[model samples]
Target: MPPVGRRERNKQEKLDRITAAAQELFAERGVDEVTTQEIADKADIGAGTLFLYAKSKGELLLLVQNSGYAEALVEGRSAAERIPDVLDAVLAIVRPVVECNRKQVDNGRTYLREIVFGDPAEPHHRDALALTVQTEEAIADVLRRDERFSADDAAALAHIVSAIMFLSMAATINRTNPINDVVQEIRDQVRALLRG
Candidate 1:
């Protein structure tokens, strides 16, 4: 690979700072309470510079949450691989993601709102969407482990499972529920899906 130029390195450094600052502030206070100026000040960059990286607080939230979601998906995929039963493997893939999303409930819920309502042209939003696709792919891989499901069936079922997981997380009622309860709710829905 070619060596990175100074300009590229500098840009990446700025983005890293921005992401770290947003992550800390959002965790400390929900996204609604954190101001863009605060994030720029914490990142040690001018407000305009921060805008160049992320157009809005929603984008910053997307950037910050995307990394955590990716890590959780990876953890879930690894856990799913060890479980032999189809439903168990699927929930293994789900539990970590639910935990990650529930870490800061409002922030996680806001991230989901952004995924649904934010502009698709935005880079951070696109990254979040890609992560969802990756998640479905991970679940499909687990479903495929069962002999009854063909590749197409696994993929289709995985998509439904993804919707169930996301909806459960984003639901207003689940907002106050413990992460375990939310995850169990998803497990019940998924178990029924598998049985039918």
Candidate 2:
């Protein structure tokens, strides 16, 4: 592989350090009590430098969420797009979530609680919604690439997929409601929809 360009490498390093420090702090202190100054101190950078990488607490949390989603998206795209068959498409997605959830078996509850119950009033909420739309659009691209689903169907399915993902994340950590059984039922329902 080609060596990373110096600028890109430096930027990534900064982001990595900031995110690592923030994660530790978040895990230790929770989001409300953890401030940018503290993360900067832990990261060995000025407080202003922290905001350069992360605008607010919400962006910091979103950054962490996206870090997980990035790997999941790549694996999902690779596994799903590998086949012309739609069942393969579903596998690409289901397999990644199951795999990620398995890998995150320990961290899932902590991360999920922080993400779901994290501060929605933070400045980055609107931006997060925009990013969510873009993500759905990207997922839509995969469904659209298949000739099986029309634009309308693809859009509807994309919404369904996004809804399932959101609900899965929500239910995964619910105290009264573990999602393992529900996910299976939901998967069966979606499979029927996809088949129809």
Candidate 3:
């Protein structure tokens, strides 16, 4: 890889500051409560510069979430690798993402809503969708390692499982119910699907 230029490093540093400030504030105050101005102030950048990084609050939330979700997927896959059962393995894969949602439930709700249905023409939305596809691939990898399905079957099943997980998680958000209940329900549904 070519060495990063000073300008690129500075830009990344600024972006990191923005993402960290946004993540901390969103976790503490919820997304709807935090303003882009506040995030810019916290990050020590001009509000206009913040706009350069994320066009809207929704995009800011996506920026904050993208790396965390990526890390969670990696962790989930590693955790799943330790589990023996395919069903449990798949659940393990999704557990980190669920936990990520719980970290900033309000923002997570908005993020999920936008990323799932937002226009692919938007860069942030496209990046989020790409991340989701990577997650599906990760899940497929787990299934392949388990020897529970052919490569093609695992790829197909990964999409089904991802959809199920997202829908289940979406239904559970802000419902005044335990998150685990929804997760358990998803596990049951997935088990049924795998049995067929």
Candidate 4:
């Protein structure tokens, strides 16, 4: 691979700082309470410079939360691979993601909102959407382990499972529920879907 240029390195450094600052501030206080200026100040960059990286606070939240979600998905996928029961395996894949999202409930909810409604043309928003697709594909892989499901069936069921997981996490009633309770809720729904 070619060596990275100084300008590319500097830009990545700035992006890293911005992501770290936003992650800390959002975890400490929900996204609504943290301003773009606060994130810029914490990152030690100009507000204009921050905007150049992320056009709005919503986009910044997308940038920060997407990383957490991606990591959770990876953890969940690894866990799912070891479990024998299909439903249990799916829940194994779900539990880590629920834990990650519920770490800060409001931020979790806001991140879902951004994924669903943010401009898809934006780079961060596109990355978030791609993560969702990756999550669905992971779930589908687990479903395919069962002999009863064909490829298409597994894909369809995985999409439904993804919806169930996301809705459970984003529901207003679940905003304050314990992560275990939310996971159980998803388990029940997924179990019924698989059994039926």
Quick one: best TM-score, which candidate?
Answer: 4
For each candidate, what is the lDDT? 0.95, 0.65, 0.85, 0.94
**How many pairs of residues collide in each model?**
0, 0, 0, 0
Task: Tell me the tens digit of each residue's lDDT in model 3 across 140-169.
Answer: 887787566899999999999999988777
Off by over 4 Å in 3: 1-3, 145-148, 172-174
Q: Each model's TM-score, in the order given?
A: 0.97, 0.64, 0.89, 0.98
Ranking by lDDT: 1, 4, 3, 2
- In candidate 4, the residue pairs with backbone N, CA or C atoms under 3 Å apart (3 or more residues apart, or in different chains) clash, namely none
Q: Write the per-residue lDDT of candidate 2 for residues 114-148, one digit (tens) a residue.
A: 44565655544444454446556656776787788
lDDT, candidate 2, residue 175?
30
lDDT of 4 by residue, 1-196 (tens): 9999999999999999999999999989889999999999999999999999999999999999888889999999999889988999999889988898888999999999999999999999999999999999999999999999999999999999999999999999988899989999999999999998
For candidate 4, what's the RMSD?
Answer: 0.8
**Candidate number with the higher lDDT (3 or 4):** 4
